[model samples]
Target: MSLAERLVRLPDPRRRRGVRHPFVAVLLIAASAVAAGARSYAAIGQWARSAPQQTLARLGARLLTSLNVRIAPSGSTIRRIVSTVCPGGLADLMGEAPTGAPAVAVDGKSARGSRTDTALAAHLLSAVTATGRVVSQLRVPDKTNEISTFTALLAPFDLTGTVVTADALHTQREHAKWLVEVKKAHYLLVVKCNQPNLHAAVRALPWQEVTARRYDRGRGHGRRETRSVRTLTVTGLGLDFPHVVQAVKILRHRTNVKSGKVTRQIVYAITDMTAREASPQFIGRIARSQWGIEAVHHVRDTTFAEDASQIRTGYGPENMATLRNLAINRLREHGHTSIAAGLREMSYEPFTRPLDLLGVAP
Candidate 1:
């Protein structure tokens, strides 16, 4: 079924007394507008007003009194529908990934523009695959944090045999145990000063004599970085966390090509993979893939203007964010790496371009 057909499963939140626009149609317009570079609610409304009748019709909009025209929902109507629709339902609809995601990264992003004195911004915890597919997302509840919401964010997916990676903040003993025992998944967690003992032990491993298990060098944005990694089996290390296998230490040297200034840094990571199961190279790749979610956040904030969006009311901010990610994932699926360029192309041919993205025919 097409995306429009699938969206009809969501229950409409509005009253039937005086409803004008179809809920699914309004959602389609909102999604298509975001895909076409509509940065704000006003822009979304404007896009609806200017959309071609055939495009609107294909997206489920109704016929108007004139046969050649379609009724576009007003800005307020679109805002209300979008802000009231269940974010969880929309997230499910938008987050469709293929089976067998080997490595998944969990991270959190706060909508900075939604901050107010009455409440903090909308903070959402998301699970994304190594290839930039957002599998799921959940809102971190008020007065709570991502640590408390991590399990909820990842609970819906079948994670058996998948390697889940997260930043140090999510490296709790309970989380590690749950991922291993409950989900039947492996975990690669970074160890920072947050867990003092584990960090100290990982730092204390004898490494001068150990050969480099992995080496990678790359240059980007006028800077060059070289990474050397070594691994140690910590099965009997008596660590505080549950399940033990390997510990990793990495040294990074970064240099500025123009100024010839060099800087060095160290990082530590832990994983449940044994030497036979996952080599140092696999661990390093999964470690690097953890930043894929960060890249998605950067794209949302920079290309989609997510951080600048001021839709702070109700579910509006998070729903808008889901649409933004939908656009990014759509563009990536269509073989566009540059989201800015994709937006321009979609907008240049607004009538058919956005519909093509929405899986609608015109």
Candidate 2:
């Protein structure tokens, strides 16, 4: 189904009587506007009003006055419907990924714009694929945090044969067991000071004897970096972690090209993936792929200005975040590597361009 069709499947929370705008149209407009670089409700409403009559009709936008004179939903209408719509349902509708041994990175981010006196910024845990597809997301409830919400965020996914990677905060024994024993999936969890014994044990393993090792180097943005990863099969180490067949250590050496400044650090992780199931090179790739979640957040904050937005009331922040995710995924699907440029291009012709993103182009 098309993106519009997928959006229309969400249950509308608005009352029926005297409704001037269709909820689906409001959502579609908001999504398209965000995809086209409209950051706030006012910008979304402006984009909707500026859309061509033919484009609005193709998006199934309701007629506020007459068929001959097309009108778009105002900022309030868009914000109401968008904030009230279920974020999880929208994510399920848009987060359709193919089956494979995909590397899924689980991470959390806080919307700085949502901060208020009574509450802190909105914290959300998201599972993103290595290719930058958002598989699922859940808001970290008030009085709680990401560690408490990690398992629940992953419950809706079919994780069989997938390698799930997470930071040290989620490196709990129960989570590791659940991923391996219950979900039939593999896990590569980082070990840090949070789990002292595991970190020490993993760090103490004799990695030099391991035959499987990998090295990679890259240069970009005025920096040169080298990464080396070594994997060792842990046998009888008596570690408390469950189903850990191998441990890995990644050493990163980075230098500033201009300033000649150098920095080096070592990171550790334990995984159920055997040396045969995933070579050291593959493990290195999965380890590096964990940054994909950060990339998604970066786009939302910088390109979409999600952190600077002031729409924190009700479900507005969550709803806007979901729409932003859809926008990014849509652009990526269309082969746009640079989100800023894509948004700028769409911003130039908001009236006609959004139709293509809505899959309602004539």
lDDT of each: 0.86, 0.83
Candidate 1 regions exceeding 4 Å error are 65-68
226-259: candidate 1 lDDT, tens digit per residue? 9887888878867666886888887889999999
User: Which window of 10 residues has the lowest lDDT sum in candidate 2?
Assistant: 92-101
Top-scoring candidate (lDDT): 1
lDDT string for model 2 (276-295, tens) is 99788898889878966798
Each model's TM-score?
A: 0.95, 0.95
Model 2 stretches with alpha carbons more than 4 Å out? 64-67, 96-98
> Would you give me the overall lDDT of model 2?
0.83
Collision count of model 1: 0
Clashing pairs in 2: none
Instruction: Give the Å shift of residue 277 in candidate 2.
Output: 0.7
